[model samples]
Target: MTNHTPPIIGLAGGIGSGKSTITKCFNNLGVQSVDADDVARLVVQPNSDCLNKIYQRYGEDILMNDGSLDRRSLRTIIFNRPEERTWLEALTHPAIKEEITSQLSKLTSKYALLVHPLLFETHQNAICQLVVAIDVPKEIQIQRVISRDNTDQESVEKIISTQLSNSERIHRANLILENTGNIDEMNAKVFKLHQNILELISC
Candidate 1:
């Protein structure tokens, strides 16, 4: 890699919209990636400071019998109540941001992808040189989530309702990838974008 700073590309999409699928495409092309969701999960591991704070606030019921967080219960709480979501974000977003920054700094790839569902929501998009929004129809998103996660439609809809609308995400992004359920097509699109990113960065 050149001494020039590697460009950070933020990948944004709704739940089940296949952000990870495209991130994996970039990974296959030799780019490194940092996922905010993965970072969030890491920060809340059992015995971690974040977990301790959460337990303090919400009490032992928020934990599983194994002592890990009861993520499903917490998800239900936050999605149903806006104030709870705000409180949770205030507690976790900063730590997630710090971890993401540190992870990005250590990447040696020509370009890096930061995959975040809340890229625009949490203002994390500001750290990215560009953002790619994966565009999938709402029905497709709901279907995919139900099929892949075995989740109910109501829960999926509730999650989707919390996120930026398709138009809003597109408005905030530099590029858009329409995911129509064809893996090969998506791969081709990502590969082209990868090459384009490399060329642009090399300049």
Candidate 2:
């Protein structure tokens, strides 16, 4: 890595808004990205301290037969109980943040993409030089999440309800990418935005 740290560009979007797809497009253009969701999973690997604490709190029922966290079960629990969600966030956020920082520092790209679903909600936008918000219709988001996760409409809608609305996210973002089209179109949008980002930061 160079002595001068590359600017971090944050990617923000609601569930199933195609953040991962966009990240892949940036990766194809040689931009390295640190995904908070990936970091969150790493912090809770079977024998890790975070996982151990979670097991102690939620008991063995939360673990799969293979000993990994049963994410779907835990997701149901947290979504139904707001207090439990808060407790889980308190336990996990700092570790996630630390790992995100460590991973971001190792990147040698012109700009690092910090892919986070709750970029603004978690105040992670503060660390970013710019933020790109992925905008999709509410119905599309619901349908995509349900189809992708094999979850029900109510569950998908509940998750979306917890996130900032598309308008709010767009208002807060430095750039917006609407994802109502097919993958090829989305890829083109991402490539165009990637070049725009390079130009913005260069100036």
Candidate 3:
């Protein structure tokens, strides 16, 4: 089937940079949004093949008593080991991408706001007509992650290490939504950028 319109707006940013907030704002505007995080969660849901593979590969250490994936423990295991991280990524990303592609195939909107922490890193940015990065200073990023994830500096730093830097993210994005401002100000910025995006595809 031919799509009437394809996904166009991609939101990529560090863990605590408010990409989800911006995506929600767009959703309120009637745009369908696809979340890579949600997609990732589906990939590892209980009793899923991916979960079985992970259990077999990583052993039973990552499972909870309730038969669900212990995401935190799994994260700790992969955080310090590059080979294990790569192995897990290899196992999950393809399935995640397949599911996302199926979802996108059915999307009928001027654009879909695709929220991904590592959208660019996966070579998926090539499909997005425009990318918006909700930018924050590094100091703020570190603090936000530590606060939001309730993790210490060392773990937060390791997570950040896996992601691209602020300058690098800005360099790769077509637009930057700097969120250092107040809520009202940030809302205004998001609205303006939304308008600009509408104009871009309209032209």
Candidate 4:
């Protein structure tokens, strides 16, 4: 758990709180990032063992004609049913964790960013040396999600309901980055945070 080993920085934020923006900013500063969403998708690709487990649990209907897991269909199922979501998480989380750990082990940067929307829910924050939550109002989250995802307000709210609230994340995180301001303000916060993180790791 020494900082000399390239600390894992968990970027935890709500559905539309701009975690991706922070991740991109870190990337611009030459920091390595591993996104849990990307790892989740990768583990379920056409021929993966995780996909086999999913098919075994949900049956052939969850698969496409091309033998790939129909992610949209599965997402609909799990999000609507807590039992199903739990079952799916149990099957996939372990694999995702393994892959993320492996990827982090290979990072050469001063720190590696683990971008996860469900960082706290999945308990992925346990692996991070520091956790930073991006903050925004619930209204802003809903509006931004609707605009960015082309989804309805109700749908965005439903997704938000499933995640830990902004306040909870802010309380739990080591630092908080408020995103209510403009992009320039957000960039400044990211830059300052980057310097602060570098100093922390160096110490």
Candidate 5:
């Protein structure tokens, strides 16, 4: 990979808004992506300092039999208590940001896709030359999360409620990609947007 630090294009979306699918489409076009969610997972892996800190705070109950973080259980706790969520974010955000920067630095693409649900929330948009927000209907987001995670509608709603509203995200984004259609339609939209981003960045 090139050591060149390319311009970043941040991707933002609510839970289950198909950001991953869109990232995959960008990857197919040879654009490397650095996913904050994936980095978040990495920073808290079993035996990591972040995980050890979490275990100290929340106890072994938050750990699986194999010693990995029990994410679903932890999610329930944090979502129910805003204070706990704040504490967790305080503990993990810096580590995740560091990892994301390290990964983006190694990408060979002309521009790097930074896929982060909290791109704007965490002020990560500051690092991006442009930001794209995926806009999906709230109902569709709930349905997709329920189907994909085998989660309940209420839980999905709670997650969505914590995120920026669709209109707010659209207002903040440099561009918006609507994703309420079929897979083929989404792919087409992603391809077109990919070209547009390339053109914009080249100028």
Candidate 6:
């Protein structure tokens, strides 16, 4: 039988909540970290099997002039039509999950951290013993998205609507990492939490 020692920590949050930064702190401490967003970006690169399948399903209009996946076009299609979104997820999510699971299994660290935006929403709790949700205020998330992505308030609301609410995620997680502070504060909180996670994982 295959050994089933799983990841020790799962870091989750909605977009613009500094989940990447939190994962980086763990990286500095020599923890193995895998980010789903980064994986998603890689999985959708030009000429990738996922991108080719999407092109076949959705047509060439979804490609930019440079022949890369036109994320805006795909996003518009997915957001405007839930059916389309489900189709894309059906095609891609399994591949993402399988790749992540494989990478996690290959890690040599004493513990691993899965940094996922939708850990709770996708019910990936099986991978990690301690699920830490980064708690950022809804308004802050909206403002960050608006400023960082140059998107409008309506789009921000729509993206937020797609995610599980902060309270719901908090209730689902084993721990919560509040992240509505400056970089120094964020680093401190992450460091403290990493220690706690190490202790917990050692149990």
Residue 39's lDDT within candidate 1 is 98
- Most TM-score-accurate candidate: 5
Q: Of 2 and 6, which scores higher on lDDT?
A: 2
In model 6, what is the error at residue 52, expressed in angstroms?
1.5
lDDT of 2 by residue, 98-202 (tens): 899888988989999999999998899999999999889999998988899999999988888888999999999999999988889988988899899999999
Tens digits of per-residue lDDT for model 3 on 71-130?
999899899788999999999999988887777777876777878899888877877889
Ranking by lDDT: 5, 2, 1, 4, 3, 6
Q: What global local distance difference test value does model 4 have?
A: 0.88
Q: How accurate locally, in lDDT, is each candidate?
A: 0.89, 0.92, 0.84, 0.88, 0.93, 0.83
Q: What are the C-alpha RMSDs, in order, of all predicted structures?
A: 2.1, 1.4, 1.4, 2.1, 1.5, 1.8
- In candidate 4 the C-alpha lDDT for residue 160 amounts to 91
Report the lDDT tens digits of candidate 5 across residue range 1-203. Answer: 24479989999998999988889889998999999999999999989999999999999899999999999999999999999999999999999998998899988888999999888999999999999999989999998899999999999999999989999999999999999888899889989999999999999
* lDDT per residue as tens, model 4, 82-195: 999889888899999889888888888888999999999989898888998988999999998899978788778878999999899999999888889887888889999999
Clashing pairs in 1: none
Q: How close is candidate 4 to the true structure, as a TM-score?
A: 0.91
**In model 5, which regions exceed 4 Å deviation?**
1-3
Clashes of each: 0, 0, 0, 0, 0, 0
RMSD of model 4 against the true structure:
2.1
* Candidate 2 residue 176 C-alpha distance from true site, Å: 0.4
Worst 10 residues of 2 by lDDT: 1-10
Worst ten in a row by lDDT for model 3 = 1-10
Give me the candidate number with maximum lDDT: 5
Candidate 5 similarity to native, TM-score: 0.97
* C-alpha lDDT of residue 135 in model 2: 87
